[model samples]
Target: MSTPDIVLTRIDNRLVHGQVGVVWTSAIGANLLLVANDAAAKDELQQELMTATAETAGVGIRFWTLDKTISTIHKASARQHIFLVVKTPADVLTLVKGGVPITEVNVGNMHYSDGKEQISKKVYMDQADKDAINGLIDAGVKVYIKDVPEDKEQVLQKF
Candidate 1:
């Protein structure tokens, strides 16, 4: 198996949306959109939702669990262009540790959750989230906080 070039890896709470499915996908020119989330992988409804959204964007999508993602990393990397979407920073850390070779990550929209503090207009992070993101940074992954493809990339420094 060949290692696929993961062109872009984005952390968006809403994995597939107009901003991501259309804007980011088009900007990155990705042929494949992989949604690596444990919950979405096991839930048929979530898979269907992502599939439908990706279909609208005219891109291929696959919802895979962490383990599944690791196992299939080589195959995914073999592709020409791949845009990976995960729900959290923790997921990104896992992918990197699993030998995905993610050097940078776009922190899109984490949304306003219960304990998450608003770091930017479209981003929110709790302690654990912050730690995970920091971990990626410490591991040499350049983390950029940007909502859309047109926005300026901001480095997350709230940790």
Candidate 2:
């Protein structure tokens, strides 16, 4: 099968669960799912878990480390539709810092953490998270919050 068009979404929880596999994918018509996370890609257990979750989505899923993902997306020889997802603000930052070509970011689900303050009912941002997100904004990448397909998307600056 060929790679599909990528719909980039930034979800902080690290797992591409229900809202992602079913809701977002269906809405965006994603056929190839790319979940970029170092720990999960390197760990057999986590990979297995992610694989299991992906199997139910009726989409081709690939787990990639930051570097591999960046290269894949950057390659001129490679072209396929992809639903690109990264789990953290840091991952987004990493890609930007590495000069990965990105224009937009969509927040899906970022769970509550000790230092994380709720930016919205479905979103939260720690100071560093804010800075990282803002950095993406500074670099001209659009950042928005939408926990699921049906939720309203708010620009990160509004937070």
Q: How close is candidate 1 to the true structure, as a TM-score?
A: 0.94
Residue pairs of candidate 2 with colliding backbone atoms: 3-80, 3-81, 4-80, 4-81, 4-82, 5-81, 5-82, 6-82
Question: Which candidate gets the maximum lDDT versus the true structure?
Answer: 1
Task: In angstroms, give how far residue 46 of model 2 lies from its true place.
Answer: 1.9
TM-score of each: 0.94, 0.87
The top-ranked prediction according to TM-score is 1
Candidate 1, run of 10 with poorest lDDT: 71-80
lDDT, candidate 1, 32-141, per-residue tens: 88889999889998788778778988998888898898888787545458899999999999999898878899999899979999998988889999999988988899
Whole-model lDDT, candidate 1? 0.87
What's the lDDT for all of these models?
0.87, 0.75
Per-residue accuracy of model 2 over 86-154 as CA lDDT, tens digit each: 888879888878767677888877878898898788667798888888888888988888777677778
